[model samples]
Target: MALTPPAWRHTLTEVPRGAAGVLRLAGKWRAMATGPRGRGEPVMVLPGLFNSDRSNVALRRHLTRMGYRVEGWGLGRNLGQRAIGQDGERLFARIDAMAERYGAPISLVGISLGGLMARIAAHRMPGHVAQVVTISSPFAGPPDATRVWRAYQALSGARIDDPEVRALVGEAGRPLSVPTTAIWSASDGLVGGAICRGEDCAAVEVRSSHVWVQFNPDVLRAVAVALAT
Candidate 1:
């Protein structure tokens, strides 16, 4: 028999909280400069599934104020397999160009599905990527464990269980030569907390919903700490 679906009550609560977080970002935009900064090394921020670079505006602004040269993947919207395009040649090319521009390996900070992309990129070209940090990314469970699976299918027209998707999902648990940090949240509405923890990843926990994690103060602090390491 199929198991009963988990309660998504918390997920529903995220709607208002996410909106509030966006407002908080607008008010505190300038204060971001007061925090600790990075080495001005290149940091590329990738958005979650169905998200465009616009969703990461607050994150990029904070990171930029922290003295890091950060850029978003210019790709319009993240479309699962389609975003990678033709064996991920387009994505790889982006990584390669960043590394070349900086004259050193680049750090990647990805949210949700974007996190999975970062991990794969790091593994594929460890020489180009310095480290990877994933926020609210499910690394220890199947794709179905995520609340967005159905929405993902609806938006991308790709089966969550397809062979290629399965292979990419499996890569989440595999360790990479470059440093990796998985920042998860117990309050995440979309992804279960347990599945976000990966055996091969250095884990950090935050108290925020999956949607607002990108703008959560604690999450921002953790991302900085991860990149500074």
Candidate 2:
């Protein structure tokens, strides 16, 4: 079973209130030091909901340097909806093409809604995906745990109670057949940490903001390690 709000929120909410700025600066410094070295199989980095390919450029660059062929979803922007299956199908097709081009299984590194999409793709096409990594993704529940999330859902025409959303979340509860890792922060101001847990998946806890997860050193390290495996 997943943790309750009181149990998880206390840990996740404390950092954003106090040391967020410091962490952000540290994250940037780490990115500069890590530089680009590049190694593993090809990787697809997907941005969060409402985000664009540019949003994940730094992370993708780092992964490229780490010896991995990194690519971003060419989708224009993320608009939160349960019909994400359409986008997932397109992304899967892209992954298939990349696999053919690279001649190796692809690892998916996704944030927020993109993570859910990656999970769906991996579940449906295990032979094509080698591993999956997610940051601040709500795998086990809706994203609208807070009032701000509720507001965003309403503004974006995303129905939190939509049947499709419920089904997606439900699918997340089952054990993933592919190797999976989830990187979460104690400072995510968006989705509750309770929804980040996985039964058989390796979960790494870090200190970073929800918005800047892709830039955090700890989160990046966790993703790199997961992909390396």
Candidate 3:
């Protein structure tokens, strides 16, 4: 049995909380810059499945004000392999270009599936990525554990059980050469929050619904805290 997807109660609460997140983002966005400010560090924020860089504008915008040099992937919508390349060569290219442009390792802040990819990218190109911060990304559990499995298959054009994909997912759960922060919520409705915790990462709980964990004002503070330290 899939030990995830949360309970019916949590799943049911997603829509309402997710709706509130939008309002909170617009009105309570100041918290995003409350933590330790950045010192011109290169930070890249990756969008979730089916999302584009546009989805992260609020978060990235504040990060810039906090003093970090922030940028979106600029690769357009995230269609899994269609965007990152079958072997993730495209992701590697992005990392390489950013590292070159920044003249230093870049920090990766990813939401949901994007977080999984960020972890994988850090592993593939060790030291190129300074650190990784995952928001509600289930890298530490079976991909099927999430309610988004069918959506993943439809969008990524790959099965969760496919040998190659399985290997990559497995790799993402392992310890990284750089620091990692796994920010998840027990109140999440779509995926198992437990699965989001990495083996050797700093785990933070924000008690949010899965749909908009990335947009929550408190989540913004969490991200700022993660990057600052």
Better of 1 and 3 by TM-score: 3
Off by over 4 Å in 1: 1-6, 27-32, 85-87
Q: What value of lDDT does candidate 2 attain over all alpha carbons?
A: 0.71
| Best model number under TM-score | 3
What TM-score would every model get versus the actual structure? 0.91, 0.82, 0.95
Candidate 2, clashing residue pairs? 12-186, 37-65, 38-65, 38-66, 38-67, 39-66, 39-67, 39-68
Best-first order by lDDT: 3, 1, 2
| Total clashes in model 1, counting residue pairs 3 or more apart in sequence or in different chains | 0
Cα RMSD, each candidate:
2.3, 3.6, 1.6
Residue runs of model 2 more than 4 Å from their true location after superposition:
1-40, 146-148
Candidate 3 segments exceeding 4 Å error: 84-87
**Residue-wise lDDT of candidate 1 within 1-229, one digit each (tens)?**
3322234886888878676766776676566556566879899999998899998887887788788999998887998878663448888899999999989999999998899889888888889999999988876678787788899888878898888778887875577788888998777788877777676778998877787679876677788788877
Look at candidate 3 and tell me the lDDT of residue 219.
82
lDDT tens digits, residues 79-144, model 2? 655325435566668888988889988888888777877787788788888888988887866555
| Better by TM-score, candidate 3 or 2 | 3
